[model samples]
Target chain A: MLRRFGLVCVFVSFATLPAHAESVRITQDIEARTITLNGAEIVIDRIQDSENRLEGDFARTSRPCPPFCITPMTVAPGVVTLGELEVMDFLDASVAAGEGLLLDSRLPEFFAKGTIPGAINLPFATLDPANPYRDEILKALGATLTGSDWDFSEARQLAIFCNGPWCDQAPLAIRYLLQSGYPAEKLSYYRGGMQVWLQLGLSTHTPSGG
Target chain B: MSATARVTTTLNAPPDYLGGNMFLASSRRLPEISMLRALAIASLFAGITVALVLFKADPGAPPAAEGANVTRSSAGFDNLAITPTAAVPQVAQSVPQAGPRIQDQGHVASLPAVAADVDLQAMTRGVLAELGVTPPAPPPTDTGADDPLHAMSMAALSGLRKMTGQPDPAQSPSAFQTLIAQALQAGQSDAYIDALLNEAAGSGRITVPSALVTAEGRVDTHVILSTIVAQAAIASGQDIGAAKVSSSGRIQPGQQQVYTVSAGDSLGSIALRFYGDMSRYNTIFDANRTVLSSPDSLRVGQRLVIPTI
Candidate 1:
């Protein structure tokens, strides 16, 4: 009798236990450029052609995931990896050739002092957000922008660098180029940035005024 | 009446009399009485057995053999007494043993557990001290004009020297001054020269400008002139020259690119669309300067000028 009673108690206890909680889901639509979370649409404002501060904010908050969590859908052209030594060689060759444009994404103060020889200062802050000139600039130089109009596509051979590996500016700049329509094959990311250049024996320039 | 009295007398007679009396009395009366007595005894025995079985069958019955007798000569007596005595001692010993034993067990269990709780702040402080981290003394508050341009110039010269594998160029102010004179003679922008100086200072290849030195060893120049020059150059790039007149004289890129203002759009949106970025929205304002007083006053439809890149 006691054994039978114990069996009944066990069954009752098992029947009364609670269930587990579920996780929330967030989704994005590339064609419509919309995002949905938990069955509700989310509207994102302040997205520009040059730099999307909204996207940057979104990337920062999407923790435990890649910083820029775009969907798997291939909407924009991909990025190119320029080997470290090749980038260094390019810088040396550019100086010798006096033909390449050294673009710095650092603050204006950093650029004013010494930068790569013949480099131009086009701070990320200056790019046109609404109708980004990444395409136009590349086009002016006889280059092509890669993907969609909203993307940042610039020339393939262009070398983009920021402060260093620790800096996200260059990556964002590269992303901007890829989105704008620059061919993935032509672009090279110089991961070793100004710090590396400065560490190595390289040229820099400063404007003359006080 | 005579017959009933005789029968009663016979029934009441002693067992010996019944056995020894007439044949009917001996055979029938005594035998029948004995049979009734046997039946009564059997019924009583059966009732006792039923009661015992019922009690044993009860679920709440006392444990079997709980008070069972043991042989007096057995070792049980000694065991019982010794067990109580031994138990008393164990209880006394357990009081002290429990505290330390439990504590030791807890210590053993928690030692590894507590290891991971190292205080990061304390660790950082210790490491910083080991690394010779000292608070930097506050900068001098009194100096001449803090022209960022001059700083840039110094920085550029220092950078140039470092690049060329030469010794620090700012070691001799005269050489630096001569170099500046030569660059200026060669028609370098004054802003460019200042930037070079600032860059030199930034790179730690030059001392603070002599102009910054004041009486009592205090330096106070805080003017960020380099920043101003950079801003001016950026502004110049943003400014639209003569509106590029295509053969049709229409705005080259178009009056406005179509845009669906998203949730985050503002007047800055329209301006950035028409202009290259937000900074050149002022140029759009200048183009429509007659109508829109501020860039903020823009609707989804309002056509605006996009300045040349």
Candidate 2:
């Protein structure tokens, strides 16, 4: 009986030892058009052809997972113009790029007086905080996060302008877009705003009632 | 032969008593020895079981009191007293032994009240400092109320008068001179008045002339009158050349200089029309103070002094 009990104890200890180790699998199959992680897949459909190339450039700077698996993407440098760019340059680029312009001034009276033609007014106040677009902003813009209502996915290039040099509204709006993952190259700032236009003796049209 | 037979018979008869028989007898006793050994083992096992039962039944039984007094004297009583020594040795080694005893004993009696008194004094000083009042020295007295020379100074008195909208008597001449000069120099044509006032006011040096009055207690106003004539001439769309007074002391080009004041004509507007800047409107206000209670209350056809630069 003693010999039998000793044999049983040894068998139980051997059985308790681990049989297999756990691991994660990442697969990028060309046929799938998706990034598969442990059999779960996330699709990439709306990524543009040019943007795809840009993303590839971005991936060079980003850290890749071990065994050539997950590729973390970052914004490619040399896109956004730092400091100040001329308003005329911005306007010409915006028109050439076919991107819609957004004027962020909130004062309806001032907007009625005179503003950039074909520009839509979306005040920065209306943005919802829980939106993923805002979270993307913290990643792209770094520590400078002055939130605004400019969608990165909808518009390819967004030009924001306000009163003039004294105006901080457009810069703050641009910061929001840049932070929100809108490509800095696609963002334009019209620094010589309405005041400069008026001062240069350019034609200005007021709203019908104004 | 009989002795040999006797020995044989005795040997045959006593075979049971022989040493070989004794050896066989000892061999037969082995089973008995084994039984006795088993019985002794069984007895030891029973003793062990009994001892275990007693131990389990009364595990915490106290020691017997044999030689209790000797044990107490030797170690037990002394050890009981010395056990707390381990706890106290560190405190004794670390603390200063003197002076604190007196302070500890007196702490409740005198220390707290004295500390509270000092704190209250400091707080009072802070409050006084915040209130812009100097704190009183020891044995506090009300110094502010008792100060005899705390009355307002001449400069402060003048500031108070200005606040009250009453001009200081000493400064009356300068004020009067400035008012008269402004009234005399204000003009009528918008562009000219604006340009003139802009130049004059920007220059930062306006000369105030001495007051001159007429016999009937009216201000003798050669300067004011000429300024008005010149501005009116400009406003009437007639260029009155060089603004000269004839030898008879009458303004030349009288018809061209006189302006029929119209509706929507404010002293400032009129000044701007003639002086080019509205700041020279004060000239009109000073000139017409006797008739025009305020610049805003001007009547349509009221004659005004159109000051000249």
**Leading candidate by DockQ:** 1
CAPRI-style grade of the A/B interface in model 1: incorrect
CAPRI docking class of candidate 2? incorrect
Candidate 2 lDDT by residue in tens digits, B146-265: 111112122223322332234443333332333333322321111222223222322333221111111111121222323333223333232331122212212233222333444334
lDDT of 1 by residue, A161-197 (tens): 6665555566665566555555565555666566555
Error of 1 at B301 (Å): 12
- DockQ score for model 2: 0.00
Over B25-50, each residue of candidate 1 has an lDDT whose tens digit, in order, gives: 22332343333333433443444355
Poorest lDDT segment (10 consecutive residues) of candidate 2 chain B: B110-119
Error of 1 at A78 (Å): 5.5
